[model samples]
Target: MSQSSQFKAMEDYFQSLLNEGAPEPSRAEPAPQVPVPAVVAKPTLEKPRQAELEQLLAKVPVTKPTVAAPVQAAKPAVPRTPAAPPPVVWQNIQTEREFQALFFSVAGITFGVPLTELGGIHQLGKLNTLFGKPAWFAGVMTQREQQLNVVDTGRWIMPEQDATPDYQYLIMLGDSAWGLACHELMGTEWLSRDQIKWRDKAGKRPWLAGMVKDKMCALLHVRELLTLLKQGVNIDGV
Candidate 1:
């Protein structure tokens, strides 16, 4: 069928029969559409929470840095020697009999006393000073129940020499109550008669037996020493 004839037929059918001749309505034209512009939305930005961030950081445990201590070196120990006991050698000095003599020093001067004649040796203890005594008379000290007179040996032996000496030991004379104050007590040694330069006669210094050649010190005559002490005379019995 022709396109225009088909439309005219559909239109003839829709026409009213009562209408003798109806005029064709004029076709209205459609309006054109205008294009809309594109819309771009801006990004939304949020601010940082100062209080919430601090709370999270505070919840975490904080660890402090550790420090090591410095090491130190140790020192070595030193050795010390103890003082020895006084020596005891028994036997009196005889003409043909061998003897042991104790050598001691006072104010740097050495003197030897026979072991037999030496009553006892004691460390210097507290002294009981007495007045009116000689300048050489140091003082008196007591041991056990006996009283002993301590002679300032240095002052007695060398009256002209003036000075004070620290006496360490008191050397007893025979069985007398007198002891010579000396500084250092050199141990005893064996000595023969010939080894000693014997005195054929009594000399000015009667307390001094003789000079010991090898020792180069005075050998004490305990008997005379006790006599001089008892007499309250000086070393030369002056």
Candidate 2:
């Protein structure tokens, strides 16, 4: 039998045994029982009047002090890129004549610097960071007893990403302490004037000279770049 069935049978046997052994009532009648006493009700309290309540309230302070909410600071204004591509400023850069240019990469983007505008190159050294400076600044590195201000190239060129790319070498701008941090040196190559898409008028990027046709890289206008860098502006002029 199942456990439940066995339990039911045991229960039935016990009930039968209890019924057989149960006591019987006597035929003679017993004395009558006394009646229960009545219970007393509690007295109800009267509610206070409006005037009495007002008087009680007046005893307490009239006003409770409140705390003011904290205010958030407004962010600084940022410069915007043009909706349309800007015209180039270097009109004579792209011709049949060839000029040697140094090619390099930062993050993933490539940029070419003209040999005539090239200053010097240095492997990354110990950088001394400062306080209360712009985000595009990559600290300063001293090489050969000369201090060079390093630019976080990726952040300066593409601020939206706000990237910190691994820098291997510093490409110094002509005769300036300002150097751009880059990952790789793609070496120098002679490029004809027609090999680059020169900008006739500087648009949003005042630093860009032209787009190298073969490498699909940016060509830097060193003179304009130095001016922008001296003013502490990024490629977007901010």
Candidate 3:
């Protein structure tokens, strides 16, 4: 064979192999499977059982039963009523005899009075002049539905000293009233009847009840003061 013809046949064979290898691949077919149906089972019913009957029969003839008599109940006892308590007796309460005393300051001199007879201490009120009276009997004033005869105690006790019109206070006795014009009301204190010490010899004046401690305290006789006021007597008398 000639070298060129052999080369041409080899080239033709190679071209046929390339054309067949370049072609598109075909898809594979799926396998077919047979379908199976689901199985269904039917329910079974059971029959009911029968119950047996029992019979009761006596071999001998039956007789009626005898009943016993009923019993009587016991009687209840009567209850007695309770007695009432005794009445309570109450005793009367007795009060102690209490006395109040006052301290008055006038011109540096100090004096005190038993407040038992003293009605009250108050500020100077409007004065009502009383004629035919001493200078010491300043005037009159109405207080608590009673006539209060105003007396300048400072001037009456110490005539040497003059009375300052601004200084004044009321001294109220049991059912009797008087004004003790003083420089100041120095408050009050509580004292017992035993606190008083009587003088060895009675004083010339009955108005002085007694003395207390070192103080020359004079218990202004309330009854005497009221009596003197009623009689329109000069209280300035010793």
What's the TM-score of every candidate structure? 0.59, 0.59, 0.49
Best by lDDT: 2
Tens digits of per-residue lDDT, candidate 2, 69-142, equal 89879899798976887755343333337889999998878899998888999999888998876788889898
Off by over 4 Å in 2: 1-96
Model 3, runs deviating above 4 Å = 1-98, 142-147, 199-202, 214-216, 232-238
Q: Where is the poorest 10-residue window by lDDT in model 2?
A: 87-96
Residues 1-238 of candidate 3: C-alpha lDDT, one tens digit per residue: 8999999999999988888957565566755676676676665333322111111233345777978788878779678677787753322111135577787776666766775566677677877987788667778777666677777766766666666567766655555466666777778877666666643332354445566555556655555555555565544553
Residue 139 lDDT (model 1): 88
- Give residue 104's error in model 3 in angstroms: 2.1
Better of 2 and 3 by TM-score: 2
Stronger candidate by lDDT (1 vs 3): 1
Give the residue spans of candidate 1 off by over 4 A: 1-96
